[model samples]
Target chain A: MNGTLEISGLSKSYREPVLDHLDLTIDDGVFALLGPNGAGKTTLVSILTTLVLPDSGYARIGGVDVVTSPREARRLFAATGQETTLDDLLTGRENLVMLGRLLGLGRGATRRADALLEQFDLAPAGRRTVATYSGGMRRRLDLAASLLTQPAVLFLDEPTTGLDPVSRNRVWDDIRALAETGTTVFLTTQTLDEAEALADRIAVLRAGRLVADGTAEELIAAVGGQRLVLLDSERNEVRSIDTDGTAASLAHAMSSLHAHEQGLHVALRSPSLDDAFIALTQTHQEVAA
Target chain B: MTALAPDRPSSAHGVGPWRSSGVFIGRSLRHSLRDGEGMLMAVALPVILLLLFTYVFGGAIIADGYVDFVVPGVILTCAGYGAASVAVSVNRDITLGAMRRFRTLPIVSATVLAGHVVASVLRNLVATMIVILVALAIGFRPSATVLEWFGALGLVAMWILAITALFACIGLVSGSVEAANGYGFILLFLPYLSSAFVPIETMPAWLQPIATHQPMGPLVEAIRALLTGAGEAPALVSLAWSCGIIALSMVLITLALPRSKDR
Candidate 1:
């Protein structure tokens, strides 16, 4: 249970309940929370980061209760919000230095600012005002600022949503680097590729509730994998392999179809993470309906 | 792309408010100075108003001695312009999510607002000095002693601090920067309705009470007396008004600040 997150009966209501009585136990790793708009992804992240208060429930980060000891809980995590929050009027270097100072680095603030600027590849334009920076540069600067006070956990809300492919890759590398250092990352992203590429555990949220939680391979396998499709032209028969039906059953069904004809065509389509996500959410919708 | 190291310094330690406030205040001052349009509006508008009132309308309003009579009022009016800048800047920060970012940080939450308010006071003082210099250049004269001049500055500084706090509160309550400017107009126009540009005796009986009893009137009168050796400057009433505005502003700002859920 070390570096674990425990949430029990966490709920919030604004006009409508954005998060229901939810419970989860998350361990150290890159855990991606995937959901559609208004699925309470941001609301949940906000509450966990101590930016918003929950009506009821308990969320503990590294053994610190987020509600009762908010200040203490805040010290355990750093959040890079959905939007770029750097001061546009200040230069990139100034923003980092100021944040470093506020984080209690004191004399080390300047050195840390320089290191961050260099690491983020913003060294050349570090002196330029943030207002003049491109969107990608601003995103990088925002990420760099968040690293000023390295916390045990990092929350990135759609960190690379509007970024170009190269910038997105850069962010992906940074996130991987952070996780490699044993920092537990809670990321929310609309990009399925990002989730598949980095998430050790993925949770799908629908209607203010978690519909599925597992490793990518497990979820995809749970929905079944590699459907076998066959066409027997002579008898005009078709057969599909089901995971539950097993290899012997699938072979028997196919062989029965082939007994009546020699012109048989077969194709195996492996299920992807995208299939699992769609299937999980589709089931939630069916149940709700 | 350069490889980013996974190593980082831990940030669980707390930073004292005094150190954080110092950095925040410095940043605010730098921003205020760099804002060219704001600087022009704060410093130039008052100079233009002073020239217009002293040269164009001086003859029609009064035959002579208008310079000494109107100089203090012009200075106070300039301070009003500075208040508008404060309101706009504070409003921009709140709407832009900078305040939210600061709130999530480990530093003291109120330090950002305090920095902006203190910077506004400093800016207003600079603008007030510029207006006074311009007025003197354009034939305005005063007959005050060195000690009286210092006294006038202290009084004006206090008034500027109060007005800045009041406008900061207005900015917080306002929904947008444009709306904040609309709220600021109330303070900007207060000078015209007061005895700033003209004497209260010239106004109609109906407007005299308002023109005499308002905060701006007592402030202008107090500054005028100090600068020109006029008798009985209503210093007590002016001080009370300034203190009241500051107190009320603190309460309003506290209530209007952005909350965690609001962000």
Candidate 2:
């Protein structure tokens, strides 16, 4: 199928293997690449951004080969990395202007800078040097700088890892807005909540290869079964139930218990994205073992 | 919070590569201007050296003439100092992630380095002018023609480029700003030990050969040759050394740049 991002047999290793023969496809909208630490999410982002070279395989953004014509491929993408990349020597506005100029904005760079500052709520501190900016402000400024180019595809590599909930939500809103404008966003995050909130399609990666790829609902269905269970406790209390296995049997058991009016608390287990994630990963580990 | 709206199209004017690079260079220049203490050091260090050598040590050391002798030394000192300042700036940018941001842009990497080099050249020229004015005020005069003055200035600019390239490479390889500063100070001091500050012959016999062949030694000799019309071959020697060092450093830096695999 035609995709906004197409990767095949991609491999990269630094000393030890980071991304092993991995393949995946992402179309428009926010696609979240989720993995735990050292899963090569950042490595993949770096390669896709033309900042690092992969040892093997190829990636195409909007059908432009990233390795072959990096400059042209870069035109299709912008990235905000985990570390803040704002120039501390310049003011927030000046940093944006520099980015705009580098992106070929010319005299219009200043206008764009001002607009970005306003959009990112940096207008109040636009004149202040970035050295004085707080962590959240710097991150916001960094994100604003990346958007100055307005690439067809944007990469946010763990954009909200260290942010407070409010700041994270702010970034999430900005990301959602970008997607609403039909900008393809490829974000990598260790936070499952972030993935659930922003990603229309989620791909779970382990040791560089995609272990699972689907919408949250699709993944949940694939894992199978919704179970409702109860455990006996003292004083006619109900305890936890394991929701792994057949849904019909669990529901029937729950219904029977309810019919009896036994003093019980009910716990229902439908396969969630988290459960799918755990099952897929554990199965892979068991096979490897 | 305001909505995260994409910018509206306000103009159709797009910048070409040359204009964009110019803006980058101009912005860097403006940053240096705003740093008053930095500007002072760039102008003051060479002037201080010139005065100290010409007044305090001029009597003890014999040369063709005191002002002419000290002028070349001071000029080389200024150029060396200018290179160190560029190193500090570059190191700061690397540390602050400015270089990382620049690398992501569509602009060529060479342009960013070139912009910094141009700024260093310009700053060196200003520093040279300040030193000359101070020397003139203290009764130092060059009997050479305007063409010779221009030639001397060209040599100084070339020396600054060479030195700055070497130090910029150091900044690239440095692990931290503190390490860059320490190494830059060492590099700056190397020129002082050469003919730039004291006569090479005044040193121990074993050290004379090393001092005489140093990059700054020939630069000082060349500047002195042009300033007093002394006709020394030191300028030619300086030119060769400067070009070699610059070429070597640029190659190493380019190699280091691509090999940086930090995600």
Candidate 3:
């Protein structure tokens, strides 16, 4: 019954239904919430982080009910909201130290702040105010602040939404490092690439309801198998074959193609996570529509 | 690297409300000190008005003892108007997601407001002193007992507490920092129209009632009485105004704070 995160009958509505009796369970590792814009990703994160409340049902983190005992539950998780929730006037080091102290680190707060600054490769800019730092630096500082207490469950709400590719990769590396240490990171992203790259388990949400939940490969397989393409040099055209990831289908297609042509090319096109996500969302949209 | 291991939050211990408040208060104070133009305006505006009114308008406005009469009024004006910056500060925090971040933490919710209140009160105290010292340097002398001086200080403290709470609430409900600044100016203008700068009787008949009956008039009169070693009536009236403002603002702030979410 106890998991890293558990939600049941969790429903919330404002004007229209934002979350409709959504249920989810996660064991550990990086679990990503994949949805398009207005799919209630941020709203779910808001409720989990205790910044907002659900109208009905409840959510639990590590066996503590977030609605009934938010203060106790707050101890188990740290969140970096969609926006950069930082005191921009304060220097980066000061902001981290302040968070550390608030998390009950006491004198060790300074040491931790210093270490985090260096680890984030922001040691030179640590002394500068966050207002002066670039967007990527601010995101790194926000992440650093959230990790001040090294929370058991970390909620990152689109942590790299607006970052450049280089900065995004840097944040991705830090996220991986945190997971390697056994911190369960629950992230939400509209970008399928982000989810495919980082998530151990991916949940596709459509219109406030979960449409699919599985590993990347499983979802991809369920949606559709990969394609096998055969090119004939003389005709200057390509022929296609389908594979259910079986050696028999590939061998049969290859044998038929090889007997006919002197010059032939063959390739296998595996279904990408993007294909799975699109298929899942389109299926849900058609049903809802 | 393993160096990251040492930076973790030691043991997941929680912070007490008072400790969290102290940290926030320290941050608020640091912010105010670093804000050069705002700090200068908050501290120096009253002193400037005191000198300007005492020398420029003193002879024409008063028959005698102009400096002594206007100094208390100037101080009261400063006390009443000091909340503009507090409004800006509080509004900035709310609108910029600082308070949102704080709410997600394990610290007590009241701690954020407490820090703002403490910082506003301390800044008022220092600004009041600067105004008083400026009054002294300009040859304004009051023949009051030490106890009367203490009374003046106490009344000023209460006055600051009331106005800061009121303006902070205004800032909280305001749509933006610019709107909060506009509200703050309205508060700053109130004292000027009251007995803070001139006698209520000297105003036009229609405005006289407002000038005399509003909170600032009583507060200024009370401080003037204390400084001049006059009677207790003004002090009593001032205390009533201070308490009324504090109570009303507290109710308004409580009502408005809930609606400020996501703003």
DockQ of 1: 0.39
* Candidate achieving the largest TM-score: 1
Best by DockQ: 1
Tens digit per residue, CA lDDT, model 1, B127-152: 88888888888877788889889878
Candidate 1 per-residue lDDT over residues A67-147, each given as its tens digit: 888777767777888888889889999999988888778888888899999988999899999999998898888888888
In candidate 3, the residue pairs with backbone N, CA or C atoms under 3 Å apart (3 or more residues apart, or in different chains) clash, namely none
Go through the candidates in order and give each one's DockQ. 0.39, 0.30, 0.37
Query: Where is model 1 more than 4 Å wrong at Cα?
Result: A225-266, B1-7
Give Cα-based local distance difference scores for all models. Answer: 0.83, 0.77, 0.83
Displacement of residue A58 (Cα, Å) in model 3 is 1.3
Candidate 2: list runs displaced more than 4 Å: A1-3, A220-241, A245-266, A269-283, B1-17, B54-68, B92-96, B137-145, B229-233, B259-263
Give the clashing pairs for model 2.
Answer: none
* Native interface contact recovery, all models: 0.54, 0.39, 0.50
Per-model TM values vs. the true structure: 0.91, 0.86, 0.89
Candidate 3's TM-score: 0.89
Docking class of 3: acceptable
